[model samples]
Target: MLSQKDEWVVEELVPIREKVYQYLKNEILKGELKTGERLVERELADKLKISRTPIREALLRLESQGFVTTVPRKGVIVSQISLEQVLEVFSILSSLEVLAVQLATERLDEFMTKELDELIEETNRLLAGNEDEEISQFHIRINNFLYKAAKSPRLYEMLSDLVDYIRAFAHIGYEVPGRMREALHEHKDILQAMSERQIDKAMKMTQDHIENSRKAYIRTIDSVKKK
Candidate 1:
């Protein structure tokens, strides 16, 4: 785990409350702040070198977003995501992302196609090197481009929220044998379909990719529980 001390430092430009919210949210998504971990307001404020007001506000926001919950005796703690919640989020994400892929394939211009090709090449390089973190970041960049090509702000926001909820488990899935290479191939298939202007093929591939991801996450979780 990285230093919490370093994680608390906020940039000067963003509002302290917003920054705190984003920081905590990112921490939760990254699994640095594990499920059921208590988030003490005073402790957070002290660590962040800020007043408790922003910490409280950030906690409230996190709670509303299902990232944390208020326990009767525990105060605020990171939320434990259930399998049902994971299934629900991933199902919606798959449907929305398929739509996004369809729109992007239709809307892709020459420049966007070139960019996707470049990203695919980068992903291939990262895959060959077995750079899991870099590959994950590249995958995110590719999805962000797809979302941008979709031209739907509301859709993007919805997809982002869904992705954030399950993102913590993504690395765990990557740890499964051969999962990284398989995911890279899946990504390539989707991108190839989109680049070829095969809208239906792209949409189907996107749905399949997300479904496989969901299954991988569940398998990882089950393996951990058995251990």
Candidate 2:
């Protein structure tokens, strides 16, 4: 059963089914719903004070998104993040973000550069304060800032979806021991390359940053499994 804090309120604007789907997806992402945890429709319906139809719809949607699996006897269970999925997601992100950085190097305006600088400074502060979670959020902001500088809507949309998928499956890369500082240093290098309008260097740095992040996340997953 979901805790009272996790209960979904009936929102007026969104469709009930869509709201239900978002609620469930968020729970899975936040790890409130553990991997392989059984989700019985009747239980969810009773808990949410909603009908079974919407619960069923939401589960199906979550299944399609790789957030849950429908086991024969187990019903819907939260899906486990596999090694293959992690590697694949990082590979795609490396290619896509390299291109985004290349484009952004040529396109970043003064205001965009200022924003990136601000983000970098803020990340430095977060690091000094040992605010791990807030540092993770600044990483996202930095990526989004680069994507915006790329000025490619289609690329931005694709990257956004990939980012969400990766966040859902893999633990935050910065959480790995010593990775936070290293990642920030890499971010500074990438920003410097971009500031100098070195397109090729920026792209290569972006690729390297992502590869390092991939390694960090894999290490974290492996350590968890060992436990």
Candidate 3:
């Protein structure tokens, strides 16, 4: 059962299904809900203090996104996606984000460049101070900048869906050695190019940035396999 604070955070008045899904998704990503663990719908409903209908809806949605699976007589379990599947999702993400950054580059203006400069500076500060907890949040901030500048709804939706499929195991890249330094440098370089209106350079750098993350995750997988 979730604690009182967590329960409060999970339940919302509108769009209850998305809240439920996000709650469970966070659980899986943070390893609170382990891989292959059964998702007993009734227990989740009782724990969340909600009716089973929304829980069912969330589970079905997660299943379609490849986050969970329904088994015969075994109930629902977090899907243990293979390494190949992980790479495939990352490949899709790289392509989608490449397109996003390209569009964002084309639309870059002085105002947006200033906004990006501030972001990169703050990101650098966090990295220098070793603000580990803010790593994911920092990445989100950068991605949001590109996402907004890109101004493509359908592309964003597709990228988000592909991300959800592999998010449960996303810690792999973060756990890799020297990932923070590498990723931070990548962000700085990519943004510098974008701010200078070097669209082609920015596009290639963004592709390399995402591809580096994919490679880091693969290394993490290989290490785990050896153990």
Candidate 4:
């Protein structure tokens, strides 16, 4: 079904490309690289201990994903997440997540529901402690489970891309005063709503939570601009 050269290319390049992609994506999302910062191909190649070809390929993929923008002469720059962009993304995410909640509620088996309940309890425990990093990881894990429960491959793929974009901006809000606590409460509300199969309440809670996060991020951006 495949040409020898094509198969060889796939075998050799996919792993390297995936590694490059993951490394760059993590650096960007973690704010190790800031928005609007230029990414020099050679510099990244050296920093990543890889050749330019793979670096270029990775950058191209990032560009496609809205994380980077290329200017003709100036090279690639990390695209800043604007307030408008944040609002638009959150709007889409709210709609998608509402759909996900609805689907997950309708389709999830008892075992899956119990698993989510356990995750919520674990999240509660983590939040009770001061482990911010663990809380964030658990929050992401819960969202991943929700995505799986949603069960629409196309929606899942789009949301996955959107979540990555949100993560890049979300790290800014993570330090906002009271944001972590607020998010914890909001997540608990969402989980309770899901547990009760209260679709409307779950959807509204998700929407409100995302809106609050967007506002927090906007405030943070404004403070940074003033400084």
List residue ranges in candidate 2 displaced over 4 A.
1-13, 172-175, 222-227
lDDT of each: 0.83, 0.82, 0.81, 0.81
Across residues 46-122, which tens digit of lDDT does each residue of candidate 2 receive?
Answer: 88888899999999888876788988876789887778987998999999999999888888888888876776677
Q: Residues 103-189, candidate 1: write the lDDT tens digits.
A: 888888888889989977876787779677777777678778888888889988877777777675345777778887788889888
What shift in Å separates residue 47 of candidate 2 from its native position after superposition? Answer: 2.2
Clashing pairs in 2: none
- Which of 1 and 4 is ahead in TM-score? 1
Candidates in order: C-alpha RMSD to true structure:
2.6, 3.2, 2.5, 5.5
List where candidate 3 sits over 4 angstroms from the true fold. Answer: 1-13, 109-111
Q: Write the per-residue lDDT of candidate 4 for residues 120-191, one digit (tens) a residue.
A: 898778778988777778778878888888878888888888889999865677678879778888988888
Candidate 3 lDDT over 111-184, as tens digits, reads 88789889878877877887766876787678778877787888877776776555576657878877966787
Task: Pull out the clashing pairs in model 3.
Answer: none
- Give residue 22's error in model 2 in angstroms: 2.7
Number of clashing pairs per prediction, in order:
0, 0, 0, 0
TM-score of each: 0.89, 0.81, 0.89, 0.86
Q: Where is the poorest 10-residue window by lDDT in model 1?
A: 1-10
Question: Ten-residue segment with the worst summed lDDT in candidate 2?
Answer: 1-10
Candidate 1: residue 223 lDDT (0-100): 95
lDDT of 2: 0.82
